[model samples]
Target chain A: MKIYIHTKFQESIYQQFRDGLEPKYEVIFGDGEVSESLKEQFLTCDICYGNVPLDWLNTSSQLKWLQLNSTGLDPYQQLTEYQFQLTNLKGFFGQSVAETTLAGILAVYRRIDELTRLQTKNEWVGTPIRETLHLLHKAKVVILGSGAIGLKTKQLLSGFECKTTVLNSKTISQLADYLPTTDILIATLPETKETIGLINKTYLDMLKPSALFVNVGRGSAVDESALIEILKEEKILGAVLDVTEIEPLPTESPLWNLPNVLLTQHSSGGWAEESAEKVVFFLNNLAHFEKGEELVNNVDLVKGY
Target chain B: MKIYIHTKFQESIYQQFRDGLEPKYEVIFGDGEVSESLKEQFLTCDICYGNVPLDWLNTSSQLKWLQLNSTGLDPYQQLTEYQFQLTNLKGFFGQSVAETTLAGILAVYRRIDELTRLQTKNEWVGTPIRETLHLLHKAKVVILGSGAIGLKTKQLLSGFECKTTVLNSKTISQLADYLPTTDILIATLPETKETIGLINKTYLDMLKPSALFVNVGRGSAVDESALIEILKEEKILGAVLDVTEIEPLPTESPLWNLPNVLLTQHSSGGWAEESAEKVVFFLNNLAHFEKGEELVNNVDLVKGY
Candidate 1:
């Protein structure tokens, strides 16, 4: 069997993959980009590491397995008809992303952004902050998506004494009803057909004026225009968005300057050893595949999570 | 017996106090300020709520009890020789201050301040942030002052799976030994002869280069000049201070401009309903005092916490 490594990683991580797999299989290491040269090698390879364009799925009949480096597999929904088995790094991202979600929530609740503004101008103002201050404790929280992200978020919030209700496939269809009582609504769903644009104006309007909305999931899961309107009117307390409908959110986007919004620039899943962690995840799954055992994070094609 | 309310509060809270204790006792609602007229009334009043000058302790012989609205008893430590009961709102502040301490820690670990700075410039740069990104999970944490504040902080960090060791009077003298392996060091000590200037240069020198030091306790507990020197030299990772030795921190202070420092301007105890909460605490203590029972949160004058 032949394996093609086609992911951008640090030299140390690449060395790890080479040292681990090179002895048993016909291993090929391509410059970690999806260039024309790397595309040619995918034709003869039995297995590949990292994502490829959906078009490549139709041409690569020799490919048996492909491991993705990301948690969200929505983009690959189109290639479900292909013969290759797919796996994603799901559990690895939960801690980093959940911590980011909690950080954003606590930042808004404690008014850290406002304090940072004061710190930069070298001003020490105290009384005005009390008007907008809130506590995460005893909040009625609603977490969408009961996957690793949602479960980890609940466990973390356990210390805060929040009342949490996670909306999975069975419960997500009625999310609008959950918003009226929610003090903090967090979305951690992928960009699946069922989830895309789910948090529309109706649901956003149902939120209490003091409630907070956070999206650590795909931004396509929310209607950005509707969210902006609510934020402009100050209908809701605030928002913390780690992902937006567009990447590198346009310079002119109002989100950058909105006093009520904290945009994290899609860096919620970031960590110091991200590349090394991903390489380790792929290697572990590769070992499972070679042993003909069940892979850990194998994607269910129908769910497209 | 006469009880004087010497704190600013809402009319609703005043009404609540009136409904709670009007027919049996003489209830005087004095202006919030400690004026000459209020001072004269304090001389004959049986009890008072809200902080007064230390000199009032020496002059007011008829004042049987003093109820303070804050947790820190440092300001009143000088009047310990006075023959009156002193009670500070100690346990009540744990939840609010602990949330603030956690907020500061998460902000530093996740670089919320840096992201906010980038958000202001409408920059979407992502790569550089990953180098500084970290999780609160598995951190070696040391919390100073094993009172309500320290214990609550420990409980909150427990969800993050941090290895926490809280240093009270018994263990604080040996804190230097813990610094080398510590990732997060938090001080919640009150101002006392022994604790004052305890986190000086000698202890700071023992910290690992990547360690984070947080002070949500009294500012007088740390030697500000030594902390500033270490911050300037980049000897430690960063600091989050809710209390400073001199507050409304002068504009000329280097802490304002330092990349690693986050100053909260003493808003750690602030919340939306602070006045109402403090009033409720006073009312509860009043009930205890009227029954001739020991008041909750009575200060041990010798230790002055």
Candidate 2:
């Protein structure tokens, strides 16, 4: 078997995985002109791993699995477009995304946005707003996507004295028990055919009126226009978005102007290597998979992990 | 026994605590403009419940004990200038202040400051930075002042899979076991004779260059001049200050202009009704103490807790 790795990571991560497969597998570095432009050049390889978007996948034949160095599947949602199996680096970032999700809740609940503005204006507005400050202890938290990231966030919030829950593709009745009571809606899901635009007005309506919403997963998971409407109407307290449907939310977009909204450029995941190790972990399993062995985090490409 | 309640939270909170404390305690509402001063109106009572600065009690002769409605003692530290039995509200705000401390840490760590600025400029930086996301797990966190607020923050951070540690007026060999390696420094001490200027240049020099510092207890606890020197020197990653020695940090102060600094007006503990309730609890407890019962949260003026 032959495998190729293309990403900016500590070589030790790749070496750790390769040592397990031994002489049965051959590894090659995919870094340069030939690797990116002409996928046909690597037709002999059995596995390839990188965070390349669908558009950059010049070819995918002979590639048994395409391991992504990220949790969300927005870049590879249309699996049919790719010739090989697609699996994401999901579990590796649960802690970071979970930490960021809690960070968002704290940002809004504590009025980080308002205070930051006041700092720049040199104005001191220190009145205690019971309505806002009380959110931390008694909030009903909703986590969309009950994956490792969502569950980890739930666990963290549970300790902060908040009521927490999650939403998934299938009405996992177990997860549903947690959502209706949600006062804070957190999106920590991967983008899929069923998840895109899941946060329409109807979904937003499920949240408590002053509920806080934070998105750290994929932008397409939310309907940006609906989110804007919700904030303008004061439907929910506000939203903190690290991910949005479009990158660099257009300058003209209402999201940039809403007082209740908080927009971040989706910088929640740890720097590159952290995500790379997650991907490599699954790839090393594939070598054993070729030799008839059980896999650790084998994502069923058809079902999507 | 008669008790003068000088705090605004005296009414409702007393009612709430009334059900929980011994009966026969009469509650007085003194959060108003009475022709009589705190000394004139409260001399008849055996105990006074208030945030009365020592200056206000200079003319009083019957103040056996004075219970404060705050964690810090700066307001009462100069009491030697007047004579009164004293106690302060120290543990009531553990949850709120701890949450605020965490909020400041998250804001600085996740760069909520940059996010707010980008909203106005319509920039999407979260996505590009996603590859470099920071996770708090195994992080080194240093919290100054292991009082109620710091203890509560350490508990909350403990659940996040991070390293936690504390520094106070004196080294606690027992607490040293719970302290993490110190990736971030969170200050939750009052501005008083001992704590003023505690986060001086010599103290900050003990931290990692990537460390972030957050202060929610008192502005003067941290030396603003030394902080400016550290920030200008880029000794740490960033800082978040809720209280400044001077309210509304001077616009001319370079601390306000630091790219990584976040200055919030002292609003962390200003959560209205709940805040009032906490104060009231102190008042009711003072009422109980006046009746010759043990006082709840009685501050030891000599120990400065």
Candidate 3:
């Protein structure tokens, strides 16, 4: 079977992936860009790993499976139908994403951002800054979406002894009540019909003035304009946005210059060995595919997980 | 009995402290400075709630007890003799200090410092920066000292699934064995005769090239010159120094301009309600003092914890 690997991995990682496959199977690697040659390779491959173009997959006849390197299925949601089996790296990112979420929140609470700024100027604020700092210990936290990321975030927050309440579709209605008392509000929701605009001005306004807002999930889940307004007015303490309304967040956007805003540029699900790990996951799934067993982390296209 | 609160508390916190005390006991609040009036008050008071001048305490015949606002007893180590029963806030800063240590470590691993720099420039460095990012998960960690800060730091690291080895004075000999394999090295040792300059060039040289060094304990515990050399040469990944050799670390210090070094400026143990909490602790300790009960966190100045 011919396999087209579409993920843009480092040279060493690509070599590792190539070495892991059996000698009998034909394999091709793409430069992670759509072109005539990539389309030709995609058309003949029996299995494809990584996010190949949605339009290319629509017309592909021989592709049996398409494994996504990412956990989010927002891009694939646009596809009306496809014959290929879809699997995503769902649980794989839970630990990494949750870690970044904690890092962001803790950075805010400990005033690491201000300290970093001071370090650059070689200024020593010293004991005076302490009065303005906060502790995550015993803080009341409200987390949105009970998915892997949210669950892992909650688990991590437990170490700080933060009282965490996770709100999902079932418990989302109670978010308003939790927000008023919450010291930290984390959103780990996926992009869905119900999730979009869920954190509107009303919910944002309900948060305590001392509340820290964090979003590690999809940006569509929040009303970005409303969040910006509240942040500008100092209605909420600050925000750690790993995901924003747009990728490569337009330089002109006020978020880049916001006083207490920390923009991670959606790099929360990243690690040094991310590409190599994804390759291993693909190889393991490939073994199950050869045995005619059901693939893991299969996504329901209609539900848009 | 008269109590002289030498701690520089906010006006509100001073009121809280005054309110908590019994009316029969005379109370005087100091402006946290050494003056003729403060010294006169210090000499007359039976109990002192903060770190009064060591010279003044030496001649104070009326002082019966000293409740320090800090965990470290380095300042009192110089006193040759004293009549007062000394107690420090040993376990009080454990939670706050541990949280800051995690925040600083995670900020480095997740590249929050670099991201913050990018944010300032309004630069969206997407995808490429992911390769430079790291995860604290499953990292081999070595923690120096077994004090409240060190133990609390270990407990917090458990949430990240880090394999942590805590080395106190007893197991400090084994530090060399752990350093070679350690991904993160944390020093939470206090300033004592034995602990001074413990993390010198020898132990620092043993660390892995990718190791991250964190010091939240005392500046005296580490050899600043050795740490600076390794960081300058890129022998190790980075460092998070909450306590430096000289703080308000002189303007000429290289630590301020170091690429990956995060200097928290000794603000790790601070919280919004720190002064209030200290007052509450003082009030509680006052009860024990009045009843002739063994005071909590009593420091052995000779041994210097």
Candidate 4:
């Protein structure tokens, strides 16, 4: 049998990955930049070592299993009955994303943006800031998604004596009546057939005026028009968004000009070390599946988690 | 016993205070602006209700206590004698100052000032921002003075999952190590002989590079010269200060132009409603003291807490 690595991986990781499957199969490297003539070698591979390309499934006829490293699996949600088990990298961004959620909440409460603007003008406009909303203690924070990243954010905020309630599509009664009194709303729902455009004007109206809204989840979950209307009408306290429907929010986008909005690059869970780590992790997991072991983070195509 | 409210107080509280104390002693009511002859009523009073400005003591030979509605006892520290017991309002500004510290740290970590400037000029800047330090779960924070205020700051950062440590003149082993590794340092010390110049170059050098610093303490607690020197060299990350050695920070001071500095006005803990709440709490305690009840926050001239 032959194994194909579609992307160039770290030298050390490549060696270890090769060593793991060497006794059973021959491993060869092929980057996306590899010539079409060289691509003919993929036909002989038993396992395809590549992320599902954005275009579509065009794996070689000899390819049996497709392994991935990124946590999100929506891109591969519609896999046909090829009998190939797809696995993905998960839990890698848990702590990283949770930290981002905490940072977003703190940014809104502290008025960091406003204060910094004043600093640039050489104005030391010291004024008493109220501590009434200082701690998340006794606050009702609502999270819309019960996935790994959402659970991690909950765990981080849980120790601060705050009440966290998550809303999932699974119809769990334990989480009902908990959404209305929320003091902060954090969205981590994956975009899918059921979740797209889930947050409407009526949905946002349920929040208290003191509530903070954060979206590290897909931008499709929130209706930009409703958000703009509610924010302009002062329905909520503020919002911190890491993802927008449009990547690289244009300078002309109305969302960029909102005073209460904190617009960040879509870097919700990324760090300097994450890219390299994910690449290495994927290669190792690819080796594990090749050994006929129970693979970690096997994606449930139907759930699209 | 007479109560002098130098500042405007709630009428409902004044009524409650008098009703609570009227049966035990003679109550004379006047504010700090009362005429000298009228204020001389303290001469016959056993306990004069007032804060600093020893005129009440001068008028009342029988004066046995001074109930102050302020938090810090610095103004009255050396200025007052043992002729009367002095009490102050404490724990009132804990949340306010804590919020200030959190705001400052978030401002630095997120590079808020630079982002706002970019927004003003309609420039996108997070690509450079992504290169700076982040507010992920691994932040280590140290707080000087684990008083009510410091504890509140800890509670806020606790939501961020920061590794929090604290230092006080007295022992706090319940907190993290005395001099532990910290990515953020928050100073909430009050103005006193022991606390003056508490933050110096050596204290600053112990902090992690690219760490955030916040000072909600008194102006004198920080060595301005040393702070300026460190900021000049960019050895530290960034700072937000509500207090400074010199008010207005002198237009000529280099701090006004520093890249990562935020100077706020000195009203960090005071709110529009705080003054009234302070008076009510103070008068309630004054009534309790008149009945020989142990004072709630009687100042210890020796400890200077």
Number of the predicted model whose TM-score against the real structure is largest: 3
lDDT for A6 (candidate 2): 62
TM (chain A), candidate 2: 0.78
Give the per-residue lDDT of model 1 (tens digit) for B1-305.
Answer: 99888877778878877877758788778757877887888778999988777777788889889998677775676664777788998888788889999999889888899999888888998656775788888899999999888998998887788899999988887798899999999999977788889998899889989999999999988989999999999999999999888887888999999999998888888888877778778888888988899999898777665
Q: How well is each residue in A97-216 modelled by candidate 4, as lDDT tens digits?
A: 666676667656655666667666766655434323344545678788888888988887765566877778885343336546778888887788877888767677777777788998
Worst 10 residues of 3 chain A by lDDT: A68-77
Candidate 2 residue-wise lDDT, A209-280, digit = tens: 767788988888787778888789997778888777777677778888888888767667664456455645
What TM-score does candidate 1 reach?
A: 0.95
Rank list by lDDT: 3, 1, 2, 4
Q: B31-51 in candidate 3: lDDT tens per residue?
A: 688898779878888988887
When just chain B is superposed on the true chain B, each candidate scores a TM-score of 0.94, 0.80, 0.97, 0.81
In Å, candidate 3's interface RMSD is 0.7
Q: Which of the predicted structures, 1 or 3, would earn the higher TM-score when compared with the native?
A: 3
How would the docking of model 3 be graded? Answer: high
The DockQ score of candidate 4 comes to 0.35
Q: How should the candidates be ordered by TM-score, best one leading?
A: 3, 1, 2, 4
For DockQ, the strongest prediction is 3
Root-mean-square deviation (CA) per prediction: 2.0, 4.7, 1.3, 4.9
Better of 2 and 3 by TM-score: 3
Collision count of model 4: 4
lDDT tens readout by residue for model 4, B1-305 = 35444443457656755666656566666654556665566565656555636545544557677777667775566654567677777787787667656656655565555555676666665544554536536577778887888899887777566778778888534234433366777888888777888777777766655667788888798888888888888878777887788876677778788886877556567554565566567767876875788787888877775
Top candidate (lDDT): 3
TM-score, every prediction? 0.95, 0.83, 0.98, 0.81
Per-prediction fnat: 0.72, 0.63, 0.83, 0.38
